[model samples]
Target: MKPKKNPELEIGRNSSLYFAIGLNLMLFLSWQALEYKTYDKDFVAIDILNVDEELEEDIPIVNINTPPPPPPPPPVVVETITIVEDVEDVEETIIESTEANQNDAVEERIVDVSDVDVEEVDEDVEVPFAAIEDVPVFPGCEGEPRNKMKDCFQKKIQEHVVKNFRYPELATEMGIQGRVSVIFVIDSKGFTTKVRSRGPDKILEKEAERIISLLPKMTPGKQRGRSVKVSYAVPIFFKLQTS
Candidate 1:
């Protein structure tokens, strides 16, 4: 006799799989139910704005009275000119032309050199220290050779500056320090003049000029065997010593 149920076609063969799927579906549904949120219908409010029910505002109109423009300016009056007849006889003066024509002969005068007055104009000739044939001689540098006079002059100048250097009290207090360039001219009379200086500050410049002005009168420099003004420049240092 044939079996009522075949073992290969048993319904319980996939029972574990079906149980797992059903368990997973139940877990998902439980999680969704736990996360679900509900809002009260009474807590919600809906605002309905009726634009047609708005009140119309009427703005009051103000009338401004402006003053009328001023009256036009009065017309200008002109005086009438009258013609007057000359009762006395009038004589017209004629201007004679002084222009020379081809027929006119010009007088020639001879100029003699002896008759001509020659005014000698003493010109102020300035020669640079370097370009001068003879450099201004400092008092102590007279013993130096002519070839080495320039070096001696410079040495004497340095010595003089070192001896006469006095730091300005104001400049020192203000911490002003720099090199001041002093320019002065040794005139033909051997006197120092036109002493000017430029530096970082006016005080320094003034100090430098004072120092230059204190220089002793030197022997005037010569060019072409003639004494001339010699322009010389020196730099004075205003430095603060660091302790």
Candidate 2:
């Protein structure tokens, strides 16, 4: 089928001009409808001043001078009580040499010499048996020469042991026999003290100690002109006689 072209459709060709006219007309209507009113207003005042003739107010100032507060009272002084101690009764020792001439002044010094506490000395000094100048004088060895005193002392000790020798009953029964070593000290006071013994058997040692303890009080040995403690050792033999 063939389609027909209508001449009436050509009438819409000027519709663009209509659209432009409609748009301008709408713009003019909108502008006329807006409220644009005018009203009467009051004017604000603006002051005009000369810069050379300005006015300034004066501010009052006061000077203050007050005395400082008095210094704080002196601090309370606390007195300290000191206790006094009583003085001790101390004695001084003056050594006077008999042979010294009159011009020699004796030196004196304050010393706390406690003769009762001499044995309690802290340090023990050892005296050699051979180095003693004055050998400890046994009861009967006073008049003997110094060179033979040591020999005489040993002989006297042996004699004393023989006199006191009594074989321990238990040791003799058990046939326990040996040499016992006895050690003792002769103090500055010429008295025997600190007797100790060692042996193969206690019985023998006891006998040896008993004999040494019976030794007579002797003259204290002297070293360099001063009396000193002397140490001595003696050994005694014990034998079981066989029948």
Q: Number of clashing residue pairs in every model?
A: 0, 0
Against the hidden true structure, what lDDT does model 1 obtain? 0.92
lDDT of 2 by residue, 168-188 (tens): 999999999989999999988
C-alpha-based local distance difference test score of model 2: 0.87
Q: Which regions in candidate 1 have their CA more than 4 angstroms from the true location?
A: 1-86, 143-145, 169-175
Q: Rate the local accuracy (lDDT) of all candidates.
A: 0.92, 0.87
Question: What is candidate 2's TM-score against the reference?
Answer: 0.49
Residue-level error in angstroms, candidate 1, position 173: 5.1
lDDT (10s digit) by residue, model 1, range 1-243: 976877578788899999999999999999999999999999899999777766889998876786788999999999899999989998999999999999999999998999999897777899999899999999988878899999999998899899989999999899999999999999998999999888999999998898888889889999887889999999999999878
